[model samples]
Target: MLPNYLCYVNSVLVYRSGGTNRLTGLMLAAGTLALLLVGPSVIQYLPVMVVAALIFVLGIDLAKEALWDTIGRVSREEYITIVIIVFVMTGWDFVVGILAGIVFACLFFVLQASRGRNTIRAIFDGSIARSTVRRHITQRRFLEQVGTQTQILKLQGFLFFGTINSVEDLIRRALDIAAWQRNPIRFMIVDFSLVSGLDFSAAEAFTRLQRLLEAKDVVLVFCGLQPDSAVGIALRSVDLWADNGVRLEVFANLNEALEWSENEYLRGMYASGWASARAFGRAMTGAGESGIEAARTFSGASGSDMGAHKPSTGSGAIPGLEAAGLDIPDSKGRQPAFVLDSGFENSPRRSHLQQAVRMALERTGGDAMMVGALNSVPEIEPENASSSASDAEAGLEGSERERTERRTASSGEQLPPNALPQPGDGQHQSHNQTAIQQRKRKLVQPAPLLTLTFKAYAQEDLGQEFFANLAPYFTKVRISKGQKLWERGDESDGLYLIEKGILKARYDFPQEEFEINEAMLAGTIAGELSFLSGQVRNTAVHAELDCVLWKLDGTNLDRMQMERPARDFSTFFRMLLRVTEEEQECLMSYLVTRLS
Candidate 1:
């Protein structure tokens, strides 16, 4: 017979635990040799041996990660029970050990099947290095903001007879805990949202879990259950959950389920939906594989310009699979699919590309007020603007003209545009009379960048008037890996920010050059001197990785003349400042200690 258990254990352990779970392979290899010498009896019992090894190894791993204090907090019976199960599985015949542990396994199934799959799907709040989101949002088209919680989790699959033993052990062990008693679970909702099919074994396992839960005063509910499918048929027409048993209301709509579940009576209830197609999609359908395995087939907007703010959305299109977050046409390119990105080498958005373009364009003619070229944006509330103008007219039409005349005569001189207006100069007041003209501030839809910090920043701080006007003037520039933003002595025309990919800023010394290493993470500011001075770039920016940056035109000399809020631009600056300050402080502390 094929070694079913060994096959899966070897395959799964390698993928899930990587090198940490490699013991199974070694055990299996040794077991093969043992069988050659010991004969069939030992070999017949091999499955249990592998399982035992698995439990001990897994437990050891868990212990390594566990807070030992919690071990004492649990009761002895559960611990002994766990130990027995592990011994039986690891020490005896694989088939018999598994068979002997059936009681514990049964208990496990009863508990797990009762709860089904109430999952935890959250957009991890922090950097990829610190969080799991980066692992899941690997595809180039999976437009996820570093911190945006737009990513979702729809739990799929089901628990059946095969996993029943695990279910029982989990239930029994959980009940044995002091915490469970102190904070008793009253209700649990199993989301069957994505359960397309169910088998009898799983059905049997579910019943056991439900019964065990109810015994502990915990009620079970099911959601998103499609009645015609196997799980549906098993649940709707079976034992522990028949019409006579506790009937789980299957919801086709989510809002209805939410509405019912929100009742005060259901306050202590914990229920996670079981997504069927949608749930499977979370694992299978998205733009990319999200680094986590089990989700293999993924899709993305590969081989296309993503963040290049083209009024024509066509430029944002990807050649194969379109990205998840862009506003590209819905029907073009590949259908919504899931692709896995193991390394975060490829960014989900083209923000870096766009940034690089804007930076290059800035040299041509840059704006300081706006981070990117500002397209004329009509006000959202035109009527509100008109009303405000009308209010100004009313304020001006009445005593203001006479007041201006009196002030003009008293001042006795014509005021220049550069002069700060007093109460009024008759002529200076005349310009206000023609109407304080309102410039339709260009509205540019900045491509929003999601950082690992969960903070989102858009393209170019368009809030500043200088950059606002400069945004429209911005153009596209491309650079390969290790290329500098500008060479030393090249007229300092503009500055660059990492829009999508990685970039670095280096200062050239007499013999060599040095660059800020980690401090120059994405969202960093580079070439500020070039934009500020009408001279050549003092520092050279080299792309450590293939990068894209927003370039502010060097020629837009008037853009940086004054500091304005630049509205939305402040947020990006704040992010850069935060990263820079933290790094600078570390350096300063080192310098102080060295000097002392």
Candidate 2:
């Protein structure tokens, strides 16, 4: 025992100390010496079971503490991870099991991230208040049509191969629906704001979608993308589907992406002359802008350029066909006959005749003057006769001026100085009496401004008289079926009163379908959403049939405020407010009924 103590101190603790261990060694040596000298019968009295029982109880306490009660609170994937570690450690090698658990958790995490959620939240118009870009009225109408044709897919969660299928399916379905509705899509916007990460596989899906859309002549746009986001990095790493003649645009937000898409669509239409869209672009798309630039670029180099001058030639000479350029020697020419022979019997060929006629018209002076059947040039005989005719024309002109002056003075209620007659003349007395009677009639009864359906929507104090007075300020518009009157997100510039025909109010949803909100019949007031709330339009109104509507915009309101008396204008304004409230109530009730 004393030797064992010395070995333990030297090999284990490794410190030069001779305190309790040395004393214990001395005691054990003495005890062993005494036992050898006296007796060894007392060694069998120790209780080994009690010590084993105590060890077992301590192990039970540690096991109970290790089995945490909150295991169920974790995710199933985490539970699987825990189970793997525990099972392997209990049944196999501890280090190997730990390594296996780490690998399993990493794999599971990757799988979970790849299966993230992606969805669409909303779809709206580019004309919305925040997306204000200048456009012509026709261009705006086209944009409204584009709003119906554009599909916006607002995505949520991570983007990977597993989620890309669902996203692509949504787009495909939307496309199919558009085609079925006879309104094929022109643009598709994918908003990836909720995406947390991205990989090459998902980027490939976007490329595939772009190819499919391009085949249908549709442009694809990516929006709500973070610059350094995982998806952004993956997309950038792959050169972002920029190859293979397929083009796409990426934007930081939805509104910007929509604006860019609209601009691109407008330019494409202008360049291609599709649907004769160049007329709208020419007026709305300003000089040096996208629409005009596209037109100029595609219109070809033969067109006139800013500083390029046309080749000059003598009045009767054809430009670029001068004698020197034609290389015909003057010595051999008898001033060539200029006869254009067409191989036609009796009459020249159509094109040849047109060319000969054009050349004759281009000749200077009266050498080749051609006149139509209805137009004749009368010949003047001699100089004296022409002078006599000129004198007669001067006399007629003087009489016409005198009549015009008389009419002007009569309208102004002031007799011209030269037209004044002597006092008490019978003719003068009669003229004065007639003028006074006419002025009296005009002052007593003014003509009506404009005729409208004055019988509709009138209430207390707001009757035929009210509408008659208001009718002059409103403008009338007629829209055909399937034509959009105004779109959601259009400026709150006016209110409308449907005079005839039916109108449908619709809203675009995230699901890429329009929900018909209500049917607006004659007498129904539209645009109350803007008129009352002072916000942009939240719904679009389209003509269900040929509709006649009376429009009242701010210009009309300004005119009312200016031309009408203050008391009358204020009263009319208040009545309009009341009408707006009633219209809103009607709309709300319609919605409630439809929803219920």
Candidate 3:
């Protein structure tokens, strides 16, 4: 019968369990089988130890997720429970740790119940307050609550001096902040209110607080100190240190205590510096204030000597900007700073960091930031506002100074989207920035240096399907400034059909007329030698404005050669090369006719 039941359970587990749990269950079952076959000695040292080690690793993971403060102050009773279990299960009988920990936890709860006390809540002023006053506990009850409003702490079992630490820290913080504190209480409504209790140490601690508050003119109010109890009325008689200041009040009715608390609260608020601004009487009595003095009094600091405006580009060096921030613009010291505003803390940093991440993800095609699983942290922009404007003449790219002055009053002009340049050492930085701008110009026309017009004719008659098949074999590549696509005198094996961007192909020579002759843009083709023969490259290819062009290799031609229309275009290669020439001429025309 038991064997049948076991089989049924095994079928359920096998169907429902997944990888991790199945592995764990298999380990446990194998360990149990080993114990049965090999006896406890050998099995305990091997499989049991391995399983226990894995379980311990799981515990470590749980501990990492727990809050630091809670872990720091684990109760002494809980510590003893863990320590005792560990001691019992260190060697031979290892499973005893888990069993002992569970048993001790249950025992701790039992201990709490054996020493518990209950205090009743008293109602007054349409709200229930924490206090002690007259109540019915079999023919005798005094005021259920008393004194100005405060916290109620109910004690059970023996009172020790250690409890003092808890009371003092709780009270001080409560005075400044309107939150329920867990330590030194300002005004405590210790509900010995129903504590038919007495301990010299606990009684003395309460006395000390009352006196300490008196010396500092701080108040300590107590509730439910019964007149007839052994330690009750006597505690009311003893002086706290010396000043017989506001004597702790004992009440007979809950309502009376509530009425008294409301009056006291109002008086305390009036004593503080804040009164309603519209209170005419206080204003007439010279209690009102205005202007800088009033602002200073509220903030509580004097003579800071800070004049108004923020430091500017003219104010010399301010730190904390890096490529980590925006690239500071190439017009540095020549342009106004890019000021970013944000709706979050460290506004400038929040905006810069957010923009930096967006630029990185876009620049790298998302693969750079997204690995197999976790998203990588993008580069962080530096946190401070940086100003790097150079001298007045630096703005000579035009009268940029005049434009800046005209826009000075307007806080709205922001850094262009093109401002987040790719970052690295000086080497790739310029190239990456230029490449991005060049591609953007092709797509959105943000800027354009050249344009090309093209018309294609078949070198031989062919069909449309042939040309369509060959079209896909072409791919575009973008290169930034100083990127050596090919070196001079080296073999250029593959073909480049320029679709956009400035690729200036020049033979290295010094001349008075022009340093470069061919400025390739849309519909230009180059690099046919090494690409066909698979030989060494020739002619260095440097991107003028981050160029993009198509790569048409031998495989591309081979695939399209069978297509009728593609086969018809015997001079198709030369037409693509013509496009490169037109682009280069356009750039040269711009340089000589306009700028020159």
Q: How many clashes show up per model?
A: 87, 0, 43
The sequence of per-residue lDDT tens digits that candidate 3 reaches over residues 457-542 is 22333332233334456664768866777787665546775434445555454555433333343333466545655676544667
Best by TM-score: 2
- Ordered by lDDT, highest first, the candidates read 2, 1, 3
Best by lDDT: 2
- In model 1, what lDDT does residue 246 have? 55
Judged by lDDT against the true structure, how good is candidate 1? 0.38
User: Against the hidden true structure, what lDDT does model 2 obtain?
Assistant: 0.49
Off by over 4 Å in 3: 1-158, 162-164, 175-188, 233-246, 252-255, 266-596
Ranking by TM-score: 2, 1, 3
Give candidates' CA RMSD values in order: 22.3, 23.2, 33.7
Question: How do all models score by TM-score?
Answer: 0.25, 0.39, 0.22
* 134-182: candidate 2 lDDT, tens digit per residue: 2222333444444545666667666666667777776777668445355
Candidates in order have lDDT scores of 0.38, 0.49, 0.38
